[model samples]
Target: MKFSSIIYVLLVFSFLTMTALSIYYYLQIQQDKVKISQAVSSGTPLPDYHFALIGEELDHDYWRLVGKGAKQNETEYDVFVEYEGPERSNPEEQLKLLDKAIKKKVDGIIVQALNDEFTPLIDLAVGKGIPVITIDTDSPDSLRSAYIGTDNYAAGQLAGKALIEDTGGEAVVGIVTGRFNNTHHSLRVEGFRDVIEQEAGIDIVAIEESNIDRIGAEEKAHNMLTEHKEITALYGTSALDGTGISEAAESLDRQDLYVITFDTLEENLRLLEKGKVDALVEQQPWKMGHQSVKIMTDLINEKQVKKIHHTNSSIVRKQNLPYRQDLRGGRQ
Candidate 1:
């Protein structure tokens, strides 16, 4: 009995020792990883800093511009940038792509923050020591390193101011937005309302949601005009909304109504030339893309970056339309 008890005690001691050694090695590995990350972030000359840009959709013209900007810096920054996103604008799919990027442990990430749904996921990436930058739109609640995009509220105010000026500050206006819950869209609507409502002569009689579809926006614009016959102007908050608004007003043979919108897409410019649309508030998407990568690289090198970086935009009207076209390479 004594001999058996001694053997059992020896075995128990052996097991405990092995467990302690395993835990110590695991902790040492974790500490090493953290040190490496810190070293890279501190500008300790590294060969490669892999960065990924995940956007709402893969095929959109705006996102394409963003990708172009991101790629332009690959040679200059000595980094690799991979662009990926859902085939369409689906937030859930966007989340999956973010997760994949996180799993791959990219050095940094630039994402289009479309909704609050991305907030927690962005936080997760930050927790994993991956720096995140929000582009175009923002995730205000997350620990993102920086935001590089247009001031949406200001853009909306520009739209309203253009309408008021075109109509002598007295016209019934209608509004069409991509989605009500979209942060940027809501901010734009608020800015427009704030400006338009300041003049009692300008009244917004109707507001509609288009889900960012050109056809749906056109139909909604047509219906809004029919329902509110007194409307003398329309504001579209999405890229497609401008063309839709112009088409709806022209279809009704009410070309007298003033129209304003966002972006300088080719379709919007055509309407501008025809005098169907009055003005377009152009967001600098290419700059947003380029700046996003620059800021992310800075963060990876343990450099300080502003939490918010607002790109410049301008109201493209008839006079400057041709100049803008030449600058954008005649592409929408």
Candidate 2:
């Protein structure tokens, strides 16, 4: 083939590729617009109150349980509940979804204010006369109508006490959490630190953030064990942390290391049954969802609701594992 012909063919191929890419992105934007339109449409059709629950990824087991509780009360309350959010803990994405819910003018919103940055958005929703409830995490500075979820500080205390008891109040501890800036995780860490530090013999050797990434948590756990050979206990502040810590502990043959974590995930429960995880701090996610809707409904009806509702948190160990029936959290 002639060199000029070859050059011309390459130019055509490049042009076509760029055109295809542009079209693909254009269609993606269009699709997102359609979804936003549908979300906003929920505001219409009077006589039906609409509520939006926006949080972490839809597939997350904890949020699934929350959604289940919300859905269960829909028929009883004569309201519509819609749940949607990014597939990961993205504050920016969460804010965008909140904006959509606000534009939709939904009667109420239940969200996770992962950090204080969400305060302004929550206030915006409240300023629009929409009741907002913070679940899983709370934003006190925001004008949210109610804060419903576990008392993270108390839950952290439970973790600390459990760890001290298991380790005989004398050991090196490592913590794996989702995000340092996360209000819930930070509070949990604070509670744990306060209680654990009270013991003169116990020491916190390392505290790392996994950012809720499974592999990252596992890698952090492994690194902690490698770096601090004296570490005798591990604590996971996020739901995903338990599984990752377990995997790392097993791979490194650190079964002697005591493991305690938050949440009641199936994987974590299995580890508990097998005596890998010493204890789990269980939060009532179902109650968080259920109460969020109820409180929002109360606010919409002009009925006063409590400013804060602290849900139940308990420690689950192997001995009382039979009562684990209620700890099953997920979508119905």
Candidate 3:
């Protein structure tokens, strides 16, 4: 072919390829934006302070919302937030990230201390003059500056009460908790059991740990419901637990099964709307993130900082779906 003919053919091919790629992106995929960090270019002025905010599972929608909150006002506070975490829930991995942050000597850290093993590392960061703030989960014995996020015990009590009311004080409850070793989950279970035990009409038929994953939650919930056919309701004490339980219930064709779970994740809310999940424990992760940053800023500024701040939480049911638009957040 002549040079002009060849050039014309290549141009048409390139244009078609570009059009296909654009259509694929705009139609096939839903996109989301998350600020991972403020990259400081060489010779560029840095923010006044650097803060490392570590979370449980980076890909999880609830934690992503929490991270978003922490980074929302980064420019306003004049701080660079390095928000990061493992792709999945791994406490040991989170510990390693915290250690790395400490060695880097970031001005501050906001981390979810999942359990007792995290306490020592938390203290180590504090000893090195790095103000550490705990989020979501707390290391009670650690020398961290402040604690923020949900009051787990109270939230659990709320869940239990919500169940009792929904079930009319009579339910054979099967509990699907995040993890046995996770402190917040333990507290939530304890608080829930205390409230449930007080009511003679309700019985906790079985309890299982999900290891903070949907598959684990589903398998355990499915097994519990199958083995114990009398289980009238399920209480999931983690972000993804409700989704799993809902799936399990649907698979078993348990249309009358009542379900309550932690976090108002978008999927969970959708399940609530479909009547698969009866109630959701509302956690304002965005507020938790933003408020924790504000607290950390006060600490760095040498201003009076409160030792603890609990972000808002409530029990949400299908009746209130229209008013709870803020529950739609982060990548699912």
- Candidate 1 per-residue lDDT over residues 1-332, each given as its tens digit: 69999999999999999897567556644764775688689986553787889977777777777888888877788777778887766777888778767877889999988889989989999999999999989887899988999889888888888888888989998999988988889989999999999998999999999887788899999999999999988899988888788888889999788888988766677888999888889887777777777788888888878999998777888999656655364222
lDDT of 3: 0.87
* All candidates in order of lDDT, best leading: 3, 2, 1
For residue 132, model 1's alpha carbon misses the true position, in angstroms, by: 0.3
Clashing pairs in 1: 41-301, 41-302
The TM-scores of all predictions, comma-separated, are 0.83, 0.86, 0.86
Candidate 1 lands at a TM-score of: 0.83
lDDT of 2 at 138: 93
Off by over 4 Å in 2: 1-47, 329-332
Model 2 clash pairs?
A: none
Q: Give the distance in Å from residue 237's predicted Cα in candidate 1 to where it truly belongs.
A: 0.6
Q: Write down the worst ten-residue block by lDDT for model 1.
A: 323-332
- The per-model lDDT (C-alpha) reads 0.84, 0.87, 0.87
Better of 1 and 3 by TM-score: 3
Per-residue lDDT value at 216 in model 1: 82
